[model samples]
Target: MSATGAAPRRFRHGLVVGKFYPPHAGHHALVEAAAARCAAVTVVVAPSRRESIPLDLRLAWLREVHAGTPWVRFVGRHDDHPVDYADPAVWDLHCAVFADALGGESVDAVFSSEAYGGELARRFGAVAVDVDPQRRAVPVSGTAVRADPAAHWRWLSAPVRAWLVRRVVVVGAESTGTTTMARALAERFRTAWVPEYGRELTARKLATLRRSRPDATVFDVTWDRDDFVEVVREQQAAEDAAARVSGPLLCCDTDARATALWEERYLGSSSAEVRAAARRPALYLLTDHEGVPFADDGLRDGEHLRAWMTGRFRVELAASGVPVVELRGTHEERLATAAAAVEDLLAAGWAFTEPLLPAH
Candidate 1:
């Protein structure tokens, strides 16, 4: 309300334009400000074709982050036009792209944090609303994020963080310390770890069978191709969920590739659908079954097949072309080895292709 007790003015529609290279808190702030002052807001996510991140992915991330704001609509436009702040022709070309994305609707206000916000607003015949022009609010930029995403991880939303998090999968035969290693690594890093979905499914299957057969054991728990596919899908979904809340590195007991191998072991072969679901993680820690003692935990029946499974994992992992580090010896030693590998992966850093630059 105003000083005179009048309600605050609100525009019919607001417009926000940005590359949104990877939407950060600052971008969210700008959009939020627009939403607060407008009946409806349209966030135009304009990125060049040469940008590393897909335009669709940018739209999805922004839309998810602002899902609660039903009035805020996110639209994408591929603007390959050369960026030249000094050239009116370039401005016209870019505005044309933005206009087309909005279906030629009139913009009531142009919200931005850039120096050219006023000019852009003038082109649209809308009011110029500067939002944190000095970056005092969020204190971050896409350039800084792209340079070191780990350092700017907190500024990113869950979906963007999930995409940037380095995933390290710990895979091995039954009772070979895969879960232990994964949990320990997560603890060491003070991050999140994904448990084996297949194990949980196994327990569920056994419990369900016992209700009908009274004497169902782990051996009675049978698996079909659909089961493996479910495991693959659930495992990935869990990993993605964990990544959102995890630190720079995420630990996983297993992944879809491991699920594919499990499918082969049970069904005589892995199906193409299961195989296609495999996502390459940043690192794979294969726990050797040689020194580990197998314990029949009422859910495992692969003691005799441990060595064979280990061999198969090695062969498949080698063929998959993902970097694999074998963890052997005592639990302490294995944890240390896995920790070092994770540190190396973190040190290697994320490599994002540079976005197109404006003309000098």
Candidate 2:
């Protein structure tokens, strides 16, 4: 098929400016639209110190989202001006900063979704190109995402979504349905989940032991402090990697905090490294092992250690200062209870997670 339409309005350069506090799908669409019309485009991420999300993270997210679009480049700097979006003086200062930021580039067009596009364009001696002013294609914004990230989760890119995602760590003693619950919750929410990394490492050690002494089982090998440290490191890395692909909420079978408990159980004490690696989870779903039948996979100690381990987990969690909810019932019932708690956390805007800075 031959081309029938007129060429897109070509420009030497185009500019898109914003804090991009948390870039959404709409911002991406606008950047794409600008790139389609211009030879080159630069996205300005002007963030202030007052924002919760830092400038570097926002810049990295923009780069990730627009990685394939080579013509689209990002230039970020701190916006030191006061928070006065409606004031003309503020706009003038932004224009000066934007112009200074675009050193030698000839910006002939400015793109935006807000009404300020025209004024921004006039300041740069460029034509204003408004894309999705009504936001019909992507009916979402940074404000909406910040207000309720879980509600507008679909609109966020992977990296940005990961930043806002809260992990609901399913942690407890052995023989519980932590893995099963994590998988089910991930499937239910259509997101990613982190499996217990310590299990895999322990399995590897057991495999080596069997090869060396064919009669040995997983439970025969005793782990040292370094082993526990490695487990904590691997577990935290897995959770982080999973969160990048997870939507708004990450379902973690176990977290570093659990690794700390396991270390205390096996090694008689927890390592400082393991405890430090433990991140504060949005919610902890403690699966009670009472009704659940204890099944040994040759790795876990028998039901005799369940009460002791569960008690230690409770004590450790209390000291670590993470929210906990003790779940009791069948697998399905536990899932329902966990799902409700997660919903409540999201509804409350994740008040449990501490902020980067304390409020006055």
Candidate 3:
């Protein structure tokens, strides 16, 4: 039987491709158009192409950029020929390879602005539709963002631009290597990272008393309420800084949720307000496995403290409502797990970006 004769009654799939460099409002319109025109849209974000954002950052940006559109998803690989697109022979090869991979998997139509899409569609036995809402070539082109990341952002839909503001935050008690793990994830993902806010306040101890605590001087400051609030403020400031300048994704070491956890540990209860302060992150990277012998840098007293801190930190952050990914094993293993999780989120058609800091 012919392939077309066996096809589903309703259009089963749609294929869309682009560099999607921090995909903006215009990109959103294109995907929405394709989704509306078909059953499902496969959004191939080709980070491998030149003039594209880094692969990990591209995946993160795509997730937050198209959060509400459930029909569209992301892929790392693609069939793209940026310079040779004008030559049909080369273009056809690009289409053949990409189309065979994506189109072979139940694709019934292809939606694109590229002129060669129609030829590829016929080869793949799918309908072809070209969509270009804004006809002006140069201004609407994605090349603008590659040249100036700051300027063309305003042209994007408010939500998509906001998703581009996201940063992944990892929270834990002192001695958990939160900063080290954060740096690893950032380096692995090729994005910015927020250092631990508590260390900036603490005199080395993961949870220590403050200078102004009238009850006592140093020793175990965990019970000090004033110190807890101070740490929370410190975390809040860090999260704010991360989101403001964050390009694609920000990996934060610790958040206010960790502060609330410390409060619960020493004070024996969590703060509703402090917990509320942790709603900024799109997702949390929680650590489950321990690594190497921890140093007693005055800050990291022992493994018991680290374990206690991890437990308290986990409960509080989970309660705060940010989605969390528990990382474990070696640095390579942990970051690899996180990288995979981030990519999966982008593939499922959800862009996870919260605007600025969530209002307390």
Q: Which candidate leads the pack in TM-score? A: 1
What lDDT does candidate 1 reach at residue 245? 94
Task: Report the lDDT tens digits of candidate 2 across residue range 143-205.
Answer: 777777788878888787667888899988899889999899889888889999888988888
User: Taking the tens digit of each residue's C-alpha lDDT, what string does model 3 give over 163-273?
Assistant: 455567776655555688878767876666888666666554433343345354334534467677777787667666665555456788776766777677667887777
TM-score of 1: 0.93
The number of the candidate with the highest lDDT is 1
- In model 1, the worst 10-residue window by lDDT is 1-10
Candidate 2 stretches greater than 4 Å from native: 1-7, 80-88, 104-106, 187-190, 329-333, 350-360
Q: Assess candidate 3 and give its TM-score to the true structure.
A: 0.49
* TM-score for each candidate, following the candidate numbering: 0.93, 0.85, 0.49
Checking candidate 1 for backbone clashes, the offending pairs are: none
- Regions more than 4 Å wrong, model 3: 1-138, 141-163, 204-223, 289-292, 317-321, 347-360
Residue 295 local lDDT, model 1: 87
Which of candidates 1 and 3 is the stronger one according to lDDT?
A: 1
- Between candidates 1 and 2, the one scoring higher on lDDT is 1
